[model samples]
Target chain A: MQPNGQLSRFGAMKVALHRLAFVVLVAAAFGLMLLGKADTVLVTRLSHAVTDALAPVLEVMSKPAASVGAVMNNIRELAAIREENARLREENQRLLRWQTLARQLQVENQRLRDLANLVPDPRPRSITGRVVADTGGVFARSLLVTVGARDGARKGQVVVAAEGLVGRLTEVGARSSRVLLLTDINSKIPVVMEESRARAILVGDNSNRPELAFLKAKAGVSPGDRIVTSGVTGAFPPGLPVGVVASVDEGHIRVELFIEEGRLELVRILDYGPDGIIADPGPGAAARAGTD
Target chain B: MRPTLWQTLDQTARRLIPFGLSLLLLLLAIVPMTTPGFLRAGPMITLLCVYYWAVHRPDMMGYLGGFSLGLLEDILMNTPLGVSSLILMLTQMVVLTQYRFFVGRPFLITWWALALVALGAILLKALAIALLSGYVVAPGPLIASYVLTLLLYPILAWVFARTQILLTKEP
Candidate 1:
């Protein structure tokens, strides 16, 4: 009789535990629902930590698949190599003519540079890294690159591709870093209209075409106008190519980004820190020492 | 005299089988979560898992387990909170209620029932997302995803039943 009573008690305890777990799970779901849009610093750190832990496992799994994809791509490329060669030959001739023009422009640029003393001789070091992982999920517009703080990657450093600007490194781990893409909803870049010199906010809407919000009506912006960084925020350098104005619909403007977000292969993380350029020290060595 | 080793094995399997099945379903959820183009308007793998387990082993894969899987998917896929959880809980409840009909059905009939369940789950998910975001949800992707899921269900059901049989040794 005592053993039967004990068995029933144990069963009751087990049922209670199961009910407790259920309550916890439901509470977690409701908690996540309530905490929407509150970007706390702790959450950012947690996201980076989770990405850092998962990136290596993902990288290992993706390599074999990528190798198979590469082999398939090579086979396809071989089949089209003859036609591609003919196209490249014609493109090479056109490029040679452009190269001669580029040489003449370089000579004229040198002359202009000597006259204006405008060359600042930028820091000539950069770490090249491959884009190993894409943005983690549907809503996140960030990427995890292979380079991290161990590879001289620091937070707030601008990351760019061969085409144009990519984004800035927001969080850095020892082995991997998170880059907030320019097309993320939270990203807001101050940009200047290349043609009109008017300033506007390049706002990302988590879509392919980010909108240009907060542009003045008299800014005189039009479609096909070029957009470049205004460097007002100081995170990005001045005069970096951003995108082109694709459409202007009433008050909302959309830009066709220069660097394709989906097809990013390799990127160069600039060593240019936020304080890359200091104000002129006014010709005094002691003043420069204090600023440094 | 001591109980036979076969009896011990049976007892162990009876007690631990549900945990193993739930873990397998959780691992399956990771595949769809990681694959791109699948995250937004792709076949719902977790829903399939919930339906399969809810029908076959409701005692092991309960309402709470389904809800947790949905929550985990929501976090991993970055969907709006409670979206997947709500869908999964409803899917599990529906499957549980209708499980008696599926107990002795042939494999083809089981596949058809799963297709109906998947279609209902996808429609619910699309409708919820559309209402929440206030964007016109495209029905084309939803229908395509549902069809793909339905086509894949037969193969998965076969594998699931084979595993269950092998593990339980009840054939």
Candidate 2:
């Protein structure tokens, strides 16, 4: 073969190889997505590993953002203080009345339980974690909390804030945990209306308000109705306040979450039971040893 | 002959600038913006950087770099692995192929091309996510993201251009 022909052939080969590399890279990405869906454990572990390594750096980066947020919030609050004050005053009066009634009912219930000789269920323990990073994107809604597996955070644990239910711990790492917000498209919660006791599923669409689905026909759910976790599936504890029904028009009910995403700085992670409950490792080991 | 210490350091710094900037953009993407609508309409800065570097320094940025960056985004944002990777790699490949066309074009032409690429990238992301999750991922957020990404392209490109100038300066 001629030298120029050899060179041209080599160039063609290089072009083919380049195209092949591009195809291979795309195929590899597609394969990863499919693999992640098929085998969630591998994805979970990988997610945890990556988050754990980057948690410190994310935490540092988030501090400046948090400060900026605080300043903005303060400015907004100051502007709205007058109207907010009046609204809070009215709310405070209404809540005071409810508090009195609730205290009386609680006392009567305890007395009734005592008379019946019933054993009370154990109260769940909770750990507070600071928000270190938030991946608020068009595709997903998740936040990384400073606490993790080492801090007693575990998958399926309930993460809440002062306002209401925030989300669940989806991936817990050694030093960080990812909170899958209730607003994530993939998040679905079994909830019930406080007033009507009608059960439904809260489905997130990456919006501030999630929609209610699987509601019984003519369940009589209406706007302003309170929603709480049903706890029927055991994924979350019962009676955790989730949100209030914002609108119920044409069979579509939107829930206005009590917790705002911007205000999510600190959250509480609740440990309910022995199934992956985050207890001190020492005590947990001792308990297992005792059982054995 | 082996590279001297100064030469090795110079090479390392050159590689780190673009790679490090890519990562910094990722962190910026997730940074908690308190302003309403900011969170929902967060710009795809990493995507922008990927496109820019792929155009400017195709030799340094490739499939592996794009894939790794995308994987980082997926893990950070909790999306299915490879969702961002697939889109990012394709974006890099497309830009690299059209490098000559973009190289000498007016800023407006490059920006226009970037807008189209951004649209495709976002659509690809939404489609991949919907297929993987088996849910009809809404197109609203994706469109918002696309527009925001395109709008921010000029500012980001200016910054990137300055960085390029600094990087190319002789010691």
Candidate 3:
């Protein structure tokens, strides 16, 4: 690859040096990959540090696209307003009926709780954060939200969309945090089929539909069954709305997450301070959560 | 004759423009388009930038700069830390080695070269991520991004071509 006969020894030496630099850089990159695997702590800190340092700049840079997206969404919403209003009106009527029944059941449930002397579920506080960046790639599905450790967000806190549980915080920074979306391969959420009570792990395979694995054989799970966090592991709160079973393939149970691909502009990160639903997050997430 | 200090500074800044533009593209890639189903359809602007400059101005776009930008993308996108670094540097290496052939070629030929290089790049990235994570990644979404990258080369190439002409013009 010497230049077409304008090739001097000096030019040859420069190309050699350039290739050498590339080789050295590629080696260094592979070395960093090794370091990332062997020392997740260092890698995690580096991710947090860089993301935290650049959060404001990232926020500002993302605004133009955000505005454009907002405009597009506004137009679409405007177009659908008539149908949406009618649907909401019908939904309001149905909800009004449920409201009276819910009030009656509330009294009965409270009376039963008093009779049994049961401890009540503590209400966890929540903090709202804007979706600053969708950090997903071909391999990992993730997001960077504006809320972070400064805002009481932590490693194990859960993120909920308007529809359902979307993801969990895997890394918390000073002004931003990374949400490992339920579709990421590294994510293994302990969820259960709400109707059948069958326990399984919702496994992300880098696909739109995260599949359910480890379901008990012959478990009566079919399409339309609801899936929720099982509370089997305390990493996530139990009973957070997750998604519905989209299909039940041979062994794969594909779930359609409520947080659609493009509409996650804002998310809610529940505070997992003392007396939160995460009673014991085992040795992994809780310890990291406590440290930061 | 030797250039004056201001002229030297202006020339230096011009040399940095390609890298600056490439960085801007990388920053914008992580921002969502906000329309559903359009996220995966966005092209790899960084890859195209690297290829465009490597073909036209290899001296300006160095391996170290490309590697740094790749690392930045990894941090911003929350991918495995070094994966993008490897993919981008390797892609630049391909263009650097073969850019002479691509220069002054038909637009179709240049686009064809980008198509081949982009294909190799995505497959390499997918393979690396699969090996690292031990999960079988679906190829559909990855290929979708690649197709968009293919579709983008012509439009972005015209912009880069204009910038190159500007660089060569008299001040």
Q: Which candidate should be chosen as best, given TM-score against the real structure?
A: 3
| Deviating ranges (above 4 Å) for candidate 2 | A1-24, A40-42, A80-97, A116-119, A217-219, A275-292, B1-3, B33-36
What is the C-alpha lDDT profile of model 3 across B45-91, one tens digit per residue? 77888888877778777888788877877788766678888988988
Give lDDT for model 1: 0.68
Per-residue alpha-carbon lDDT of candidate 2 for residues A1-292, written as tens digits (9 for 90 to 100): 6999999999999778877888888899988988898977777788889989988887788788788878887999999999999999999999999999999999999998777555444478889988877677677888988898887777889999998899998888899998999999889999988888788899998877899999995457777889999876768777889999999888888999999776677899988767543334553455433422
TM-scores for chain B, in order? Answer: 0.74, 0.90, 0.88
Give lDDT tens digits, candidate 3, residues A103-133.
9999999998787555544467899988777
Model 1 fnat value: 0.14
lDDT of each: 0.68, 0.82, 0.80
Ranking by lDDT: 2, 3, 1
Flag clash pairs in model 2: none
Worst 10 residues of 2 chain A by lDDT: A283-292
Per-prediction interface RMSD in Å? 5.2, 1.9, 2.1
- TM-scores of all candidate predictions against the true structure: 0.70, 0.87, 0.89
> Which docking category, incorrect, acceptable, medium or high, applies to candidate 1?
incorrect
Give the local distance difference test score of model 3: 0.80
Per-residue alpha-carbon lDDT of model 2 for B1-171, expressed as tens digits? 799999889977887788788888787666565435564565777789889888777756667778888999888988889999988988988887777888877889888989888888888788888888876666677777788898888988898888888888887
- Going through the candidates in order, their DockQ values are 0.21, 0.61, 0.61
